[model samples]
Target: MRLFDYELSGNCYKVRFLLHALALPYERRAMNFHPGREHKAAWFIEHHHPRGQLPVLEDDGVSIPDAQAILVHLASRYDPAGQWYPDDPAIRARIAPWLAVADDLTGSAGAARLHDAFGYPLDIAACRRAARAVLRRLDDHLAEGASGGARWLAGTPVPTIADIACFPYVALAPEGGIALDAFPALRQWVGRFRRQPGFIGMAGIMAPQIGP
Candidate 1:
């Protein structure tokens, strides 16, 4: 297995986090996504992702692009316990929308991070506005579920791909100049996610501290 990754990309981090959680060993093909834009190079675009996206996964002669798709593929194929993408129909139905919301997060929060951290040209104000809109909805959902003692995004006992899918950008929202302070439930969710066993961190998001 191999991952074409950019160290700073939240999308790429999602894949890395899950890979660690599953204890899967894979070669890392680190790319220059920022200044060099190696992902946009002709060979990469022709073979891996036409859109020149990072976090492309290669396993057993198959190439998978898009972080969400890669997550689904990894969990479905590799997870023998059926934890990440559970088999229950109702659970899968619940998980689907949150996966879509993850893409929206990539567009808003992730784009904002690129604008600020990597100097990508984007409308910062517009990105933050859209990010807050999504965060508000997410906070409301989590807050409502908290009343019933549900924590994970899909209201599952254990974290699923839904939680992983939406986690990175939300955790890194502040880097995009979108503060998480106003959303208490969302903040708590981020904290809980960070504390999960096998959780890994990227550039902006830190791994949990071991001791005082």
Candidate 2:
């Protein structure tokens, strides 16, 4: 397997995190996503992702694009125990909406991050507002679930793709100038996620230090 990766991209980080969690070995084809704009180059666009997106996965002669779609594919294919993405219908039903929420986060918080970090032209204020709204919804959902002893986005005993889908940008919201301080439940959820076994972090999101 080969991953078309961008070192600082949260979307790319999601795929890398799952690969590490599954202990799946794959070659990292680090792309020049920043000043170089290699993802927008003709070869990449013609072959990997027509949308010129990073985090495209190539395995067994098949190419897969879109971070959320990649997460589902990796979980379904590599996770033998069915943990990251369970086979249960009810659980999957619960998981689906959060996947969409992840996309919402990308548009809002993600755009804000690109603007602040990479100097992309965008309405920073509007982006932050959208991010806050999504964060509030997520915090409320997590808070409600915590009231019933559920910690994961899908209310599963273990972290599912739902958690993986939503975790990164939420954890990195501060980098986009959207603070998590007001959302205590969301903050707690992020902390819990960071501590999960096999967890890895990318730029702006640190992997927790183990042991004393």
Candidate 3:
């Protein structure tokens, strides 16, 4: 297996995070996304991904682009019990919408991180505001669920792709100037995620497990 990766990209980090959880071995094909813009190269464009995205997965001669799609593919293929993309139709339904929301988090928090940390040009204020909005919604949703004994986003006893999909950007939102102070549930969520076995971290994130 091979992963076309950029170390600083949260999208790329999601793939790496899950791969480590799954204990999958793969080679890292580093991409110079910053000053180099190697992802935009013609060779990568024509062969790897048309959009020049990072964290493209190459396995069994198939190249999969986009982080969310990669997660589904990996879970479906390797997860023997099928818990990540679970068998229940309702859980699957809940998981899909969260993946979409994960994209919004990417548009906001992920973009903000690029702007602040990597000198990419973007509206930092707008990004932070949008991220706060998402965080507010998620915080409320999780809090409401907590009343009914929900432990994960999909209301499952175990964490699902829904949780993993939304985690990295929210965990790293501070790097984008989005603070976690107002979202206590989200802070707890991040801490719980970090406590999960096989959790991994990237730049701007370390193991964030909280005290019990």
Model 3 lDDT tens row, 41-123? 99999999999878799999999999999999998898887878897888899899899989999999989988988888888
**TM-score to true structure, per model:** 0.98, 0.98, 0.95
The TM-score of candidate 2 is 0.98
| Candidate 3, number of clashes | 0
User: Worst lDDT window (10 residues) for model 2?
Assistant: 196-205
Against the true structure, what is every candidate's RMSD? 0.9, 0.9, 1.7
Q: Model 1, 67-147: lDDT tens per residue?
A: 999999989988999999999999999999999999999999989988988788899999999999999999999999999
lDDT of each: 0.93, 0.94, 0.90
Please give the ranking of all candidate structures by TM-score, highest first, separated by commas. 2, 1, 3
Q: What is candidate 1's local distance difference test score?
A: 0.93
Please identify which of the two predictions, 2 or 3, would achieve the higher TM-score against the true structure.
2
The predicted structure with the larger TM-score, 1 or 3, is 1
Model 1 alpha-carbon drift over 4 Å, by segment = none
The global Cα lDDT (0 to 1) of model 2 is: 0.94
- Report the CA-based lDDT of candidate 3 relative to the real structure: 0.90
Name the weakest run of 10 consecutive residues (lDDT summed) in model 1.
196-205
Per-prediction count of colliding residue pairs?
Answer: 0, 0, 0
